[model samples]
Target: MLKHTGRRQQILVALVAFLVSALATVLASTVTTASPSVQPGSDGKSGSPGATSTKPSAPSSLSDPRKPLPIGLAYGDTLTWKNDQELAVGLGDAVDSGAKWIRVDLSWNDIQPDSPKTYEWQRFDRVLNGARARGLEVLATIGYTPKWARKAGCSTDDACPPADPAKFAAFARDAAKRYASQGVHMWEVWNEPNIPFWAPKPDPAGYTELLTATSKALRQADPQAYVLMGGLAAVGTDPSIAYVSQGDFLTAVCKLGGNKVVDAISYHPYTYPYLPSAKTSFGTAMEDISSAQGNLVSILAGNGTPDLPIWITETGAPTNGPGTATDGKTIPPDTTHVTEAYQAAIATDTVQAAAANPHVGAVFWFSDQDTGQAADKQHRSMFYGLRHFDGTPKPALAALKAAILAYEHSR
Candidate 1:
């Protein structure tokens, strides 16, 4: 009878153990089926099959934060006007003033006037060799369509776009090949294409086509070449004068995929008659050029190119130094005139502002020295140089040097 009771008790304990195990298995199955494995960025959300996560990563910047912002000089026609001795003096001043780059006009017309096969690179060769000798990098502005390459009715207009994009591309390839060995890696596609002064009329699509052709040719010639978009003139919207606002022009160009070809966007953010920090009627401030830069960043980001750099390729105030008005009257000196003192102060402030902005890769003072052309007198472009036409140093030269040095040291 005791053996029978022991067997019965053992059976009862086994039954309880089996029941518990079954309950645990059922619970485990329930939990396993209820919970789904989620991948990173999924956050337990459902998506279409093969769809990527909607979360966007941080946008990248084109400006290399690792490198110091280079200070450059926009001595446009200076190279063409100055002899070897004069060129040396100008470049010497640039180097002494802490400028690492000098922008010179590489006129397409001058290079190949008659035919694409006919090349006259003597002037450019001298200028480029001179610049390299002085340890100054060149940002060659290669544009101004030759008469033979201009479109119909645009024969005399150097500002006209090439009749054929291939012609421009050929020119770009030749120039890049010729100068690639001289450390001339940076090229500004053209001057201000956003105005009639550069293009017959601002056509973003045409500009993009030209830029793409030129850029591809350049990269093919020199794998390390950087193609910067033409510096957009900082002019107000005046369609009557064929002037598109800088913001509008940039937006249009960027939308048309200009960012795809160009490594950087260049602008002449001149707040002439006002400080760089002053606000324009268009609700943007010139002092903090970053505001305009930010607009460009947004445009590029929207176009899936968030990493393009912004170059202030031209920015400086022009002084009214010994110039008469076109009306045959003495131009009265006013406080508005970019005097020596004001130019110095402005130069210091402009560089300081640009250096502080991470988007700004370079700041090019409009000119190294003033020009003597009578036509320049009618426009402010004639007097935006750091030195007078005679090569005497303007107060802005010392100020710019000090500003660049201080900024570099601080960095």
Candidate 2:
């Protein structure tokens, strides 16, 4: 009887243990079934197959090619009585009227009054700081020699300078460093160095030397800023006296040690008494100036500097200057013939043409004021301004405003 009872108890205990083990296994399985494992997507880059993306999309505005046109105005004390106050006022007006940049003439003479010793920086600092305060970008052109620094043959009659490559380079380096500290960028080594008006004589070697020295020194001063070569005045009529036919000058420039020192080729493709149209106007055609610029582009493209751009530093028609100056040098009679309306029309055409050129990064009108020189009397003397000396709007001023409006609308 005792053996039978003991066996029965052991069997019952085993059954209970088996039932508990089965329940625990069922609970473990339920826990695992509640959680899911991550699966790879079709692309293998996403959470699951055909999963909706949560990544941010690119902004719509940045995806377009069209951008705001860079409009610049030529402002210098030589033309207008420019002081810090006047600069502020002019800059304010420029910003109001759609000018993105201000071309300031940093005459080598102005910054360095003497040779090799000291630099007069007060005026430059004033101009730079004033412009900055007013929110204006500067396209600074450094050229012209002071009476003391002029080479032996350089005439005091005008602003021309003899080629003293070393001295000029030193000035450039110092000026660039001083201004760079002020956050000023964008420099044009010398103004129209290929022309006799700016140079003592037409010598490509001399110009190249000046360019190389100044460029290297400028870069040393500020590696981040840009250095633009001065514009080649169009060889309008008499290509001989025009200071190394525009094309030849450009070719010479390119052949000289390549464009490692230069960034952009500055040009003055002036349209004196011409307007933009499908057909070439009387004195204007892309082909006319293409001889110079085309060769430059080709050379740059041939080299690896295909991305280099161009800037029309100065462009427009002068109603008064001699129509025969092939070098496109303007002998200002003190004013210009472009009436307010006429000037406005030309201004509009200029902006439009500049905008159309993909390689043209910027264009500055030749001048801002009539230069208050009443002694000289010619259309060049009387007209150049978008306003009169008293600050009244001219038709050309209106035209510029309209063009800017049109540009804004197109964008």
Q: Score every model by TM-score.
A: 0.78, 0.72
lDDT per residue for candidate 1 within 1-411, as digits (tens), equals 999999999999999999999999999999999775532222321211121222111111223365677788887856776787898888887898898888889999888888877998997988888878878878889889988899888777889999898889888999989888777778889899989956678888888788878877887787666678899887777989999877788788777767766667787887644556545555433533356544665766777656566788888877754432221122345433555677787788888877767777678888788775435555666777788777788898999999989988886
Please list the residue runs of candidate 1 whose C-alpha ends up more than 4 Å from where it truly belongs after superposition.
1-62, 278-289, 292-294, 321-336, 373-378
- Which segments of model 2 are wrong by more than 4 Å? 1-67, 77-81, 155-163, 237-242, 276-278, 281-296, 299-305, 319-336, 372-382
Clashing pairs in 1: 276-286, 276-287, 277-287
Total backbone collisions for each predicted model: 3, 11
Poorest 10 consecutive residues of model 1 by lDDT? 51-60
Q: What does candidate 2's lDDT look like per residue over 117-148, in tens digits?
A: 76677767777776777677777888777777
Best by TM-score: 1
